[model samples]
Target: MSSTAITADATLPDAQPSPTSASRSVAEVLVCLPAIAADALPTVLEAIASAFPGEAVLVASSDPPANASDWPSLELIPYSNARTGVGWVLAVGDYAAAAHLAVERDARAVILLGDDTAPIDAPLLRSLADSVRTKNIDLVLPRFTLGPNDALVNSGLLYPLSRALFGADIHFPLPIDAALSTRLAQRLATSTQRLMALNQGSSLLWPVSEAAAAGLSVREIPAADIAPPAPPQDDFNALFATVAVSLFADIDAKASFWQRARGLPKRPSGQASPPPIAAIEASSEIHSMIETFHLAQDNLQEVWSLVLPPQSRLALKKLSELSPDAFVMEPDLWARIVYDFTLAFHLRTLNRNHLLGAMTPLYLAWVASHLRTVSDDPGRAARAVEITASAFETEKSYIVSRWRWPDRFNP
Candidate 1:
């Protein structure tokens, strides 16, 4: 209801954490930091220290500063990073270090804080640990104060897809500051390690999916974090491709669990409303986005024909015919498009990279279509995203039937 943790009743605080279970290591907080420049390290450490004073904080990074004699009760575990980008950063060494600290220190709980995330303070960090230690919760996710325009990818894809597939309602599935019990840490570590061993170290690990599949406890805490805008050098197509590949791969790997997963996401009610975001609908790029989609229609048609049902193909064709002013991708149509793409990804109808790459423009079209449809109100974009997620849930059976009998077909 208030500051949250998405439990049955108004996040996790309403139920109260179990004191007995969390008492084992109250003073220890395993903080996983990202590799940063030397000039910035002290300020970062200070922010953490101020927020969590007098605690044994184990700060792990792929690379840590040398000559760190100044900080007390802070131990450094330097690890080797497996890949680049967020997936590489979070899934590779970062996750392993947290899991290691959780076991070795018999730590009460592990808190993941990213350098690029919004500032973390004492109360927020403590709140995350409290949820785990006091509430005896296994997973603690952050409920951020986001501007509507931020986290578009998470809104469009990660949140809805994860919700429909796993029935986990974490607002930010790939958070930099998530809390975890010992059990969750170990579970994530095992998953991460397998990916590393397979030379798929760049693979992303889905914590919410893992937690849901294992039936582990999960909670949420309030965190003040605003994601920064994309870097100038980041190409839209490439960035979207990376996330799509990871998501599709994750879905394929856990197809069985998601296939059986049912129901809408559990969105907690009554808290501060989200901040306003830019209307994709109003963006000058609608024509550009639509143009991209049309290009894909011409370029990716044969591949699309193989992946999509005839019905889906016809729907996309209709949308392609509309000008930006009139263009709209219905929620159901978008869902089927995504489901078909997921199926295509699984069936390896084309090269995986090219397959995911093809979906990016289609994704942009949906974003444009969604923004065009929703209101300009501060939280309306979120609502639009939510509606899309609901569409995904409603259409999940389509995913199931296709996933189960991918070949025995007609639409």
Candidate 2:
């Protein structure tokens, strides 16, 4: 993930002294984990003890078979080991379980710690608590950076894309690691029931979105060495596909408002000619993305034949094949790309899994185009993804409307 764009003002106070410092007030810190490596347990607990000695640190382990007694500070919260959705750790939903824990303990502030997850410096924790207490921020989301060769797929696509579309700067993007205020935890509790109903036995949670839409103040904290150095390949792919598809489903479910909001220009009364992609770059990634774009063209051929004007279909086919390296991506092409996703979003035909699968390749194409335009910095690439996501959010009303009622009529 990219670094946050926060500049400290004189008003923003620095982190408090060590947790052991006599002057510091006792703050309740809740550490939540699914499981932990037995060997790393000692260091993790020691770090927490040293970091927040002035504050009472409570560790809640949600692992199955509920093994968590060796560590002095750690406490095991036994939850049923029943299977849930794609990412359920223990007791299914992230916010549901988390909210239950905080409510039960009457915690002032809560922190989420994943198994095998490393802790950052004490100052980082202090910063998180300060953001909530000082700014009255309800949520503190940390920006996640790649650890060496380990890259989180969501960090690349879903995180940025979702932020842009929803106008939410969710640093963690997903439920990897986060901190929530007591009030925020309560608010999440109310939603938990609803979320459970929508998809019970699921681990998906929208803490950032929930907080943002509620108009709660949010801050992003940067953390290092939080996630395991490398996630298993199977685990990574599952996460990537799940996030991608779910996002597309979300977009598709909101398509009508977006299309209407875009105010697509009417085709001229007279005939129009197809635009050329001769200027696009032909680099390897771009080339691959372009190939993927053509594949989409083939898949959507059947759908477009029914709805698109003959001229538009032909033009789009040519546009899709334009080599990314050489393609300039004319304004109209951008509009069409937005429109296509709008259609998908409205239909919700792609479940979370399939939606993500379809989007990944297309996102790669966008990245390629952005790389050709920018200097190909991964951070820059990530930001470009956000821009595309915003394009979807711009027409939120259109999407919601069409989602409620699906019709193919041009907006």
Candidate 3:
């Protein structure tokens, strides 16, 4: 857990990558890049050649410096319209463009790489392709490390925050890593209208939201110390601007749904939810996710009360008294999570920071429930998170719905 140095377990040091299976040929893998950072290119290429063996397409969004040398394995597709924003630069330069090319080539899956990352197992590429090909997965991301520091930027903050907020845990929720299936790529390409809608007030595009909403299967793999390419790290101000703008935009889009769910007055009809994805069930890892949720609620009683209704508080308390096995199985608990998020989404649109903070515990409860459903498959668990993210996006207009119509269905 130390951020200062890479753990020996981070990368598969002596583990030799297995030869890729030819039978997994139905899918193709594409790696998206920014065109600079020649230093790590060879390593990435070599990894792809060893692991994937299939056609590797490099969708280059940025111009490589004039002095750079080109390699045959790398196919540079030019996308010129990439831009940065007031506070932060968009992480992937023209990610949409890269996604389009992959779809054009009939690629089954696409791996997005920032300048600072590398693949660990060449077979990992094949595994991603094969998963999409055979198992029908929509997206597959790898567990990543940020230099020797194992930066909090990746794990402690983004990953957990994404999980708690949306209920599905996608490790690199915002970063470019790993692969996306052809279906997912196509979904992105075709969602131009919806994408623009969600991004109208912001500079960011939540691909994670779209992928999950479409009911695509998504998962994450553990890829430790493979020496990722270097990144152009943004300073605090820029990072804050990026997060704030994107978060605010998401809040805006879901304004109506949030309002309706929270028992607030509704907004205009022009607003709508982002889109919904497949429902996530608890993983079978442990008996009941509800048990853990109740424990958390009890421990954080003060915080829970700040945001939850008296009825919800009493319900959760009553649920906790039952055995762990019995808590989450209750239909009411699950209903509360969906409703709470609907309410939380509403509160966020109002820009009520205090209420948002208060909603964190309820969000955590939902995440615990989600984890319970996907505990058996790490990949499934990740996808479930992505699914929730998709739901959250479509549910954005929930705030608007509540704001314009404040009829409490319960009372």
Best by TM-score: 1
Per-residue lDDT tens digits of candidate 2, residues 1-411? 111221222111112121333533243666665456666656666666666665556665433222345444444344322234453222325556556656655667777654245544566666776676667778887765643223434544455444544455664556555788888887776765554555553545556556755666667777655553333345644766655555554544433322333332333433233322234346775677677767877895654444344555676666676655555443244434434554554455444345445555544555455556444355544444444344434444443544455464443
Q: Judging by lDDT against the true structure, name the best candidate.
A: 1
TM-score of candidate 1 against the unseen true structure = 0.82
By summed lDDT, which 10 consecutive residues of candidate 3 come out lowest? 1-10
Which lDDT value does model 1 have at 186?
75
Model 2 segments beyond 4 Å from truth? 1-27, 63-92, 115-121, 146-161, 194-199, 224-241, 248-285, 304-316, 328-343, 348-361, 378-411
Which digits, one per residue and each the tens of the lDDT, describe model 3 over residues 334-396? 334444534544554334444444444444445444444444454544444444444444444
Candidate 1: tens digits of C-alpha lDDT, residues 112-220: 7654433556678778877888898888887776665566778778888888888877777766557888878877766665554555544566777788888887766
Over 4 Å off, model 3: 1-27, 38-44, 54-74, 81-93, 115-126, 145-167, 192-202, 226-241, 244-411
**Model 1 ranges off by over 4 Å:** 1-26, 61-83, 86-89, 116-118, 228-233, 265-282
Give lDDT: candidate 1, residue 145: 66
On the 0 to 100 scale, the lDDT of residue 253 in model 1 is 85
Error of 1 at 391 (Å): 0.4
